[model samples]
Target chain A: MTATLSRIELMRGLVGMLRDEAVVAGIGNTNFDLYAAGHRSQNFYMLGSMGLAFPIALGVALAQPRRRVIGIEGDGSLLMNLGCLATIAMVAPANLTLVVMDNGVYEITGGQPTASAQRCDFVEVARATGIAHSAWAQDTSDFVRLVQAALERTGPSLIGARIERGPAIAQPPRDPAQIRDRFMQAMGSRKGFGA
Target chain B: MPSDSAWAGVVLAALRKHDVRLAVYVPDKVLIPLIDGVHADPFFTAFTATREEEGVGICAGAWMGGLRSILMMQTSGFGNVPNALASLAVAYQIPVVMLVSERGSLGEVNVGQVWSSRVVAPVCDALGIPHQTIERLEDLAFVVDRSIVQAHATQTPVVLVLSPLLTGGKVFAA
Candidate 1:
């Protein structure tokens, strides 16, 4: 019940909560962990981009208002574009949920300390930025509860999960085109190479 | 400002004809009329981005989710988002239509804006995105219309650099 659980376990709990919601995973371990949960066509795996998972998820949320969209990013990635928090707040898409994995370090890059390691609170930041449904899940059970509650809510939600560090349990295939096309197909908007 | 920024109207019309419904922009003086035009229209979903990179990411997401979009920023704004362009837009082949209003090449009074104007081509070239500069109203109707189609069809980001001659550039009062 204590906080600082494995990211893969957190991702598994998150993956279990979804019922066809599109997941846009940020680059690095965030993406790899999502793949470890299971390769759902509904997941969009970011390759080289940093700090864009939330922005991309906002786009999908706006595009398909009927379908829920979740953006999963790391603290390092999310901090790269904090301005997006304002944009998400302004738009206030009811179907979007943001999950920021706060590992306090860049786990993929040899555990380099990030601002989160220095006391930056993403939940407080999200709440102050006008996201009314922001919270820190203190443990695996609380993570599920927050995500479940977020799904039932009516506005944009953000969950800051403080996770334990470890190597990615698995990595997604390196094929960007296949990942994109497959996701498009799953979204029911597949256009091959240019349809 | 030009006594008539009739070109903004032309650009607006081209955007409408192309069915680009989502317009994410970082407002600029030269591009304000177009920004206002999109906001005023019911057919478009217009939003302001705090930075150009955020705008690019939004456009990429919109495209993936089946809504055609444009990312509008002035030339200087484009400089702040080359990484987003290279990583998200170009790397993923999202085909975001980036309309940049040129500043440095014209009678630019600000030293800050000059570098972005020159850097766009080489930067875009490095990302393998094809860029074209359009000056004059007569030429835009065709270029704007065709390039948008080409961008979507090819799955590549197309940078249309709008010249000062066309937007009347930005003016500083004496």
Candidate 2:
């Protein structure tokens, strides 16, 4: 399969397809590219955390079952917490869509080779972990198609996209409180408002 | 059902009163009764997480989506969540209420539990998380209630350390 896709353009496509939805991006390029695409109140940008976007998305999916929640994670970070896939599969929150960007290297940490470089298949991992709606995107178009399907279907889908590794195009705002407040307000989950 | 002291029940009651709908946990011998209670309740979502950090991440996510969540784990599990706490919970300023069962104190026999138990409090402190160790049954409600409120109000995580003295620590048998 042709997996050579641009992470930034892929993020823009995902962002374009979103409306009244919540997205949580992992630390480094996954978040940075999302920020560079365009910042949204529904977008939660992780500043330093790795391997948590999926869990956070699972939580969001559980909290707001009606809202479509998307989690963006990178290959290196995902490997750091592979067991979370099992957790996600166990809970199986149908509103969640996990998008794993596989570039086979730790792009943010000076481009160290990750386990994905050794032929680790994240889609297979997700499938084995009991996420039935898991697949690999052959190209950018396929990635968008899978994301669209995940958004439309009732499932906690895992979409693994192979991308070209490089430096992040931009940086998200470093203020954690601001990020939380904006996301909460946008999702209508702000405290005291009965969201 | 295992513990007749009603301390863990009191903690669960406080969680319910605070509108906590989700309880993400890694099972501990000391927390089994509480976990069982949460599972039996129809109003709550009790999840058995693969790892403690996964529970933290789930709790943080649940909070962002407008759900109040509590994470219950043993002291050893606390050591596994520093990155999740620091990056996701603390960095996002997500208000999480953690119920950690104390170990390595009150005549604890296990050497494995000692190090994590000693450092759990300091770890919370270093992360700017407000924590209180409950050693008495009478202090349960007050600590649980206040910590939940304070955490939500500040949009930060809080810890309620359950002393083995209060929950009648896991009894080792020969």
**Each model's fnat?**
0.66, 0.85
Per-residue CA lDDT of candidate 2, range A66-177, in tens? 9999999999989988999998888888788999998889887788899998779999999999999999988778888999999999878999988998887789879988
Name every residue pair that clashes in candidate 2: none
Q: Which DockQ-derived CAPRI band holds candidate 1?
A: medium
Which residue runs of candidate 2 sit more than 4 Å off their true CA positions?
Answer: A191-195, B1-5
TM-score of chain B of each: 0.96, 0.95
The local distance difference test score of each candidate is 0.88, 0.88
- TM-score of each prediction: 0.97, 0.96
Candidate 1 deviant stretches above 4 angstroms = A191-195
lDDT of 2: 0.88
DockQ of each: 0.78, 0.80
Residue-level lDDT of model 1, residues A1-195, one tens digit each, is: 237877888899999878888999999999999999878999999987689899999999899899999999999999899989999999999899999998899888899999988778988899999998898898889999999888888889999888888888789888777788888777877746555
